[model samples]
Target chain A: MAPQGPRRGPVRDGAGRAGRPRPGSRRCAVTQRLAPRWLEAETFDCRDAFVETLVALASEDPRIVGVVNDSVGSSKLDAFRTAFPDRLVNVGIAEQDMVGMAAGLAGGGRIPFVSGAACFLTARAMEQIKVDAAYSRNNLKLCGMSPGVAYGELGPTHHSIEDVAWLRALDQLVVVVPADPVETAAAIRWAAAYEGPVFVRVSRTPVPQVHPADHTFTPGRATVLHEGDDVTLVSNGTVLWRALAAAEQLAAEGIGARVLSMASVSPLDTAAVVQAARETGALVTAEESVPRGGLGGAVAEAVVAHHPVPVRMLGVDAFAPTGSAGYLLDRYGMSPEGIARAARELLHRRRS
Target chain B: MPSTLSHAHLTLTRAPRPPAGAPRDEVVAQLRETARQIRLQDLALVHFAGAGHIGGDFSAVDVLTVLYGAVLDVAPDRVDDPERDRFVLSKGHVAGSYYVTLAAYGFLPVEQLATFLKPLSTLGGHPNRLHVPGVEASTGPLGHGLPIAVGQALAARLDSSPRQTYVLTGDGEMQEGSNWEAMMSASHYGLDNLTVVVDRNGLQQGASTEASMDLAPLADKARAFGFAVSEVDGHDHGALLDLLGSRERPGGRPRFVIAHTHKGHPISFMSDQVAWHHKVPDADQYATARAELDALAPAAGGAL
Candidate 1:
C-alpha cells in the first residue's frame, strides 16, 4: 500500500536525466576517468554475464549442474542445457520439486544451480528453500533470474520485489544482489566456489558496467563507487548505477555523496555502513524493491545498531501502475535526480 | 546427550538381524521379532514422552524394520558414503518410531532413546539430518521428502551410481500437490533406482482418508503418474522384504508400493482407529498395548 503523506518527498525534473559528468569529483581521481564508467552508452543484461560465467565454471567442474523449473529460456540457460544435457535437470514447472531436487543432488555430491523466475522461485517454494537448503546446509545455488520489479508491466505477481527480505531472513542462506555484469559474473563464480547455500539475484533489466573487468567478488564486502563526505547513498541491484549517477549530480552541485554498492544483503557489510554513518552523519538508501524491507531496511538496521544517522530510504513503496521498468523506477523516486533530492533533504534535516 | 535411561529405554538394544545369507523363512522370522520389539520400544517412547504420532509410527514399524534389517545396504559406519542407499521418512510425524528404529539398527546409541522429545534433545518431534547420524534428510512437513528422494535418485543416475533411493509417505499425505510433482519428474526421467512406499493406513489426523479425501484406486493414480504400482500387506515382513528388496524395475520406471496397513496396527484397541493417530496412551492403555506386543513371541524384547 502506498502511504498517503508526502513519502516521496520533493520531485525534481532533472532527476530522471541519465548521466551528468562529475569531472571535479573524487571518482575521477580514483578510477582515472572524467565520469564514472557506468555512465557509458552501452548497457548489458546481467543474465548474459551470469550464463557465460556459469558455462565457463561448469566446464572445469563436473559436479556443477543446472536445475530449472522449466526456465531454461527465461533464465538464459539454453547454452548450459545444450552443453550439459544430462547435467541439466529440468523438473518442469514445479518449484517445490525443483528446490528439493537441488538439495538432493547436493546431498549426492553434485552442486546444483536452481534457476527460475525470481517471483516463483522465491515465493512458491520458500519452505523448501528454507528447510531443505538453508536449514539443512545443502550446498546449493538458487539463482533468482529477473529479480526485483524487472518484470515491469507483467504485474506485481511476477515481480520479486520481496525476495531479498524473504531470503536474507533465513539463517544459513547467503543473499547477494550484483550491481552489474562484471559483478554478477564474479558473484556467480564466487557462489560456485563457496561451500554453502546462496541466493544470487540475476537481473534481466539492462545496466551499464559498474566495476572494472578485473574485479573479483568477496562476500560481505561493499564497494565504494564514489568518495564523498556529505551523505552516503547505499544501493545495489539495477538501482546501483542510478545511485552513482545521483552522487555525480550531487558532486556537480558541490554536495559530496558517498556511493556504496552493497551487493551482499544477508551478511551485510555493516562495517562499511557504520563507517559511512559515522563519517557522513546522514545516509540515503535506494533499491529496486520495496522501501521498507530490502536494501533500505538493511542499511537502516545496520546504521541504527552501529552508528545512528538521519537515514532516508527510496524504493518501490507500492504496487506500481502500468508502466515500463524505467518509468516505474522513476515514479518511485529511485531515479538519479530523485535520489539526489532525498539526499539533499536528509542533509538539510541533519543541518537543522 | 543425557545419560540416564528413562523408562523409555526398557529393554532397548539393537534389533535382531538375520544372519548373512540366511534362508528366507529365517530372515522373515528374525525381521518379525525385530519389528515386534521396535513396536514395544516405540510405544514406550510415546508413553514416556507423553506425545507422538503413535498411530503412524506403529503402522510404519514393520516396513522400517524390514528395510533396516534386510533390505537397505546402509550401515552406521558408512552413513557418509556417497554411494550408500538413501532412505527418507516423508511421514516424519513418526520421529519416535524413526529414532528407535535407528537405535535398533545401531545407527544411533540405544541409550539415546532416553533423550527423545526432551528439551535440548537432538531428536526433536521431527527428523533433522543435521542432528541425527543416519538420517538422510531432515524431514517433518508432508510432501517434502519424496521430492528430495526423487532428486537424490536423479543425482545417482547422473553419477552412474547403483545406489537406490527410497521414501515413505503417509497415505493421507498424498493429498499434498508436491508429491505428485515429484512423481511426474521421477517417471519422466525413467528413474528405475527409486522406490516410493506409501503407508496406506486409511487414516489422516482426524478422519478416515476415504472420508477426508478418497484415495481409492491409489495404485491406478500412481500408475498414471508413471510409477509401476503394487500393493502388499505392510506388516507382512516376508512380503515387504520381497517387494521392496526387488531390484527389478519393470518398464524401467520408478516403483510405487502401496502397503495396506491399519493406523495403530496390531494393537487391538488402536488398530485402524482415527483417534490414536497422535494420541498418547494412558497407563492402562500403555500396559495393554505393551502386553499385546510382548505376548507376540517369547523373545519380543530385543532378543532373537
Candidate 2:
C-alpha cells in the first residue's frame, strides 16, 4: 500500500517550490490516500522512519548499535536486525536491564541507541536513564519509538504523551521531538554526533515535512517554518504538520500565522520563544502529548519567564479513548481546524 | 587435619605482602592515617555544609581510604585514561568523605574541600561528574552506581583491558530493584572485572537495615545471583584491601564484598547510633571526636 500524498513529497523546497521526490517519498503517498482528510501527505508513521534511520546510521557507523526490550518488531527494527545482525541487542522484555545494558555498551565505546515503546522506556527505566545516561554522563541515545497518541487505539496505558514532560524535568538531558522525517533524520545524525545523554521521541503517526532538507537542528533552537505577524503556531512531533496546515488555512482567512517546529523541548530556544511572543502577539502550541510539561508547557515556561504573551495550548487533556491516532487527535481538538480555531482565539485574546 | 592446618599457616606466612609487591605493614599504616584524615575532613566539611550523612561517611571512610590510598589503579593526572581502574561511590550522600579522600590522595586539591556544599562549589551534596574532578559519575540516588560500574567493567572486558571497576553502595541501597537487575546481568555476562562493595553499616535513614528491610543472609543472595561473596570488616583497611586485590573466585563471576561496619565507627558517642547519621557534632562533641582520632597514630604500609 502506497502512503498518502501531502504527508510526503515531491516535497516543497525551502523556496516553497515543489521539487524532485526523495527516496522515502513514496511511503507518504500511501498514508496520504489512506489517512483521514485532516492528516496530509507530510505526516509520516515514525516506525518506518526509525527503522530506516537506524539501518542507514548503522551502515555509516560500525559502532552504532541498537538495544531493545523485546521491542524489535514493535520498534520496527526487523530490517535493522536483518541488515546488521550483531548490532541489534534484544534484552528480552526487561526495560530497566535493557537501558542498563545499553549504558554498558556505551561504556565499551559503542554508540547505543536504545529503542523501545515510550511508556515503558520512560516510566519503567526512568531511574536508569537518570543515573546511567544522564548522571553518568554516558554517550547514550534513548529513542522512544511510538510515543504520544501514536498508539491511540491501544488505550492510555501504551500512550507515551507523558514522556516529554517526564524526561524534560530531568537535568542534563536533551529532549527532542522531530517534526517530520527530515527533522527526524537530522535529529538522529545530530544525536549520534552529540556526546552525552539525549531523549528523542519518534512518533507512529505521520507528519509532513515542516522544514527544508538544509534545516540545521541545534539542540535548543526552534525552526520557524513560516513567518507571519499574527498568532504563532508552535508544535513538535506529529502535531507539527497539523500546525503548519493550520497556518496555511489561517492565512487564507487573512490571519498571518507563523509556524515554528520546536524540535528540542528541553533547553528550549528561549530567544525564539520570546521573539515569537513579542513579534507574533499571540501563540497556539500544539502537540500529540499532554498540555502539561510537553511543548506547550515548555513554551509557556519560557514565555512567562521572559516574554509574557497570550498563549493557547492544544493537546490531550485526559487519557485518550480507544480509536485510531487520527480519531483521537481530532477528538482531542488537535486537527487542523481545531488548531486554526485556537490560533484565532489567542489572537482575539491578544486584541482584547 | 594437622597437615591442612600446617598448609594454611604456610600459605598465610607466604601471602606475598599484599599484591603489586607493596609491603603489607606500610600499606596498612598509610591507609589507617588516610582514613583518620578523611574522617577529620568529613567532620569539618559536614559542619561547614550544615548537611551531610556524617554517620555513613564515618562508616565508609576506611573503604574510601584504602581504595584511593592503595587498592585502585588510579591517579590524579591520569584520571581519564581508559585503561585505568574505575571507582564509583554509589553511596553518594557521603560525597564529602569521598572528596576529602580524593584530595588527600592528590586526585584533587585539598584546598577545594573548603568550598564543599557552598553555593557554586563543584562539591555538591552528591557526586556530579560535570562539576567535581575525578568523580566518575553523579550519584546521590542509591542503587545507580553499580549499573554504571557494571557498564564500565563490561567496557573494560570488551577492550581486553586489565583495568578493574569497583562500586561502593550502602547496604540499604540494595532495596532498590535496579541493583538486583544489574547484579543478574553482571553475573550473566561473567563480569569478573566488576566488584561491588556494600557498606553494610546495618543502618539506613529511618532506622536499622533489619528494621527497615531485612537484607540478612545478604551473602547467600549474592551467591545465588552468581557472585563470589566476601564478608569483610568495612573499617579494617587491611581486610578491605586484601579482599579487593585478590583474584576472582574460580568461576568468572562478579564479586560482592559485604563490608560490615558501624554507622559511626570510631567516635565513642556516635558509633553504631543512628542519631548521628547526618547530625553534625557540636563544639564539645567535635573536640572529643577530634581528640580520639588524633590520639591514634598512622599504621605503617608500602604503596600498592
Candidate 3:
C-alpha cells in the first residue's frame, strides 16, 4: 500500500485516556490569543496515525507483524489485532520478551513492530533492545508509545524523558521522533519498508498538525519549517509546534529564528544543524525530554564538533512536580514565550 | 519468508557430505563420536585460548551434537532456508562448543577453531549471528534465547510453515524471569513447533542453581506453564535422540525437555565441579583433561 495522506479528524482517544481536551477547544494560557495559524488547526493523536498506517502497510505486506506486551488498548493496536489476529503476538506484560521475540521474528523473516509504553519498553528491555535488535542487526522496529512526559501527573516513574538519551546510544538503531500525525504515518510506512533496526518514539499527546498533508519521512533528514538568519530553534515531536510558535513570536520581536524539525535523533541531521549554526550564529533547541543526551545534547554534540556556535537547549532539567503534561512542558520552559526567551538569551550572551 | 535468501555474506568452504539416514544404533554411535570430536576440539580451543566456559560447553555439547548431528533439518549449504529447523543456544557462555559443533557439521572450516578469541576474530565470547552462519540468534545475556525462540515459533505458526524452533537454556539461567515469561507465551500460543531444552547441569557461576535461586520444581514449573515436560539424561545419546527426535507433544502443547547433565561431563576432575565453570586449566590439568578426552575415541583425533 502506498502511504496515505494526513487525516484531519477529532482526537479518537487512541490512548483510551478519557476527558482529554479537544484540540482548539482549549489553548495554553501563555499563547492563548497569540497562537499561530498552525496551532489553531485541528489536532490529532499520533497513535491513531501510527496504527492507521501500520494496518495499511500490513494489508500489503504479509511479512509485517505486531508484537506487544499486552499494550493493545494503550498502544492503539486493537485495530491491528482485529485485522491480523495471528500476526499480533502479545507476550503478556513482558517487555524483555517482547523485544527479544521481535528480534526473533525479524530473524524468521518477519518485520515486527514491537510496541509498548516507552517507560517500560526502553528501561525494562534495554539489554534485549541492545543485544537482539541493535548489535545483532535484526530488522526490528520498536514503537515507544506515550514518550516524553506524555503520561503527565502519573509521576516521573511513567515519564519517558530518558528514552532518547538511552536509545540514541545504540549504534544500529535509527531513533526517530515524528512531529505530528502526518509525520507519524510517514515514519511508520518508512520503517516498514526499511530493512534494519529502527526505534520510533510515537507520542499520544494530542497536538495540532505540524507537517503538511503529504509529508514524507526520511531517515536522518530534517525539514526546515521556517526560514530565518538571526537564530535557529531546532526541535521535534510535541515540542516542534511550540518552537514554530516561538519562532513566530521571535519574528514579531525583530528576531529571525529558523525552525528545523529534527525528527531523526540517532542518525541526526548534522548537516542541517551545521548549516543552521553557520548561517544563524546562535541556536536554541527545545524538546519534550531532558536537554542532556536528548535532542539538545545531540545538537550540541554536532554543533561543537562541526561548527563552533553558542547553543541554548530548552527542556526539563529535574524530576517534575505534580502537574498535567501541558503544565509540565511550560514549567520546564518549553512554552512559546519561554522558547523565544531562550533564543533571546542566546543572542544576548553572544552580544556580551 | 522471502525466497530471495538474505543471509550473512560468507565464503564458507564446507567439507563434503555424509548422509544421516543410518539405523538407530549407528546414528547414536555417530552422534557419540560427533560429540567426542566436538568436545576434544573445544577442549583444545579453550585450553589454547586461555578463556572459555568449558564446564557449560561440555555440558551442552551432547545436546548440541544431537541437534546438529541428527535432529535439526539445517544444512551448511542452505543456511538461509526459511523452512529449516532453527536452533538458538541461549547459554552463550559456551560458544566454544557451539563453534566447534558448527565446524564439525561443516558450517565453516574446522581449522578456524584456532581463532576462537583472538583479536578481531568473529568468534567472540558469545555467538554472533552476523559473522557466523547457522547461528539463529546472537545471545549472551541470560533469559534472552527463550523469548527469541518463542518469536521464531510464532513466526512459523504465522506463516503456516512446519519449521521447528528449538532453544537450549542453562538450568541456572531458568532463574531469569524472562524465561518464565517466554514459557507462558509459548504455552499460551500452544506453539507445538517450539521445543525448549534446558541444560540441567544444576550449576552456575559461583554456586549451584538450587543454592542460587532454587528452580528445583523446574519440570513442574514448565508443566504448570502448559508445556509437555520430559526429563532425559543429557549425555545419553540414545535417550536424547529418542526424546528430542520423535517425542510427542501431548495435547499439542510445546515441548520442554529437561536434560539432566553434569557441569563437566565424562571428565574426571571437572565433572560436577563449580570451579571449572570458566576456569582455564593449567598445564597439568589441561594435559590430564586432554588425555581423558582423547581416550573417548582414540582414532578420531585426526578427523578435524
lDDT of 3 by residue, A1-352 (tens): 2222333533222233424556653235445535547534566678888998999899999999998988999998988999998789888999988998898899889999999999999999999999999999999999999988888888789988998988999999999999888899989999998988999988887677878888888988999999999999999998898899889988988999999999999899999999999999999999988889999999999999999899998887778887667777878888777898899999999999
How do all the candidates rank in terms of lDDT, highest first?
1, 3, 2
Cα lDDT tens digits for candidate 1, B108-186 = 8888888889999998999999899999988888899999999999999999999999999999999989999999999
As a TM-score, model 1 comes out at 0.92
* Per-prediction TM-score: 0.92, 0.85, 0.93
For candidate 1, give the lDDT of residue A42.
54
Expressed as tens digits, the lDDT of each residue in A1-352 for candidate 2 is 1222234442222111223444544224223323243332344555676677778888998778888888988877899999987677666677877777677677667788999999999999998898878877789999998888777667999888888888898898999998777777778878998988899987666566567767766999888888898989998887777777778888889999998888999989889989999998788999888879888899999889888988899988788878666667767777777888888887777677
**In candidate 2, which residue ranges exceed 4 Å CA deviation?**
A1-43, A59-63, A82-110, A127-132, A135-137, A208-210, A303-309, A346-352, B1-19, B47-50, B298-304
How high is the CA lDDT of each candidate model?
Answer: 0.86, 0.78, 0.86
TM-score of 3: 0.93
Residues B1-304, candidate 3, lDDT per residue (tens digit)?
2211122212222322336566898787778877877777777777777899999999999999888887888999889999899999999999989998898888877767667898998998999999988999999999999999999998898889988999999999999999998888899988999999999999999999989989979888899999999999999989999988884656669999999999888889999999999998777887798778777773755221
Where model 3 places Cα greater than 4 Å from the true spot, the runs are A1-28, A36-39, B1-20, B298-304
Of 2 and 3, the candidate ahead on lDDT is: 3
The CAPRI quality class of candidate 2 comes to: acceptable
- Candidate rank order under TM-score: 3, 1, 2
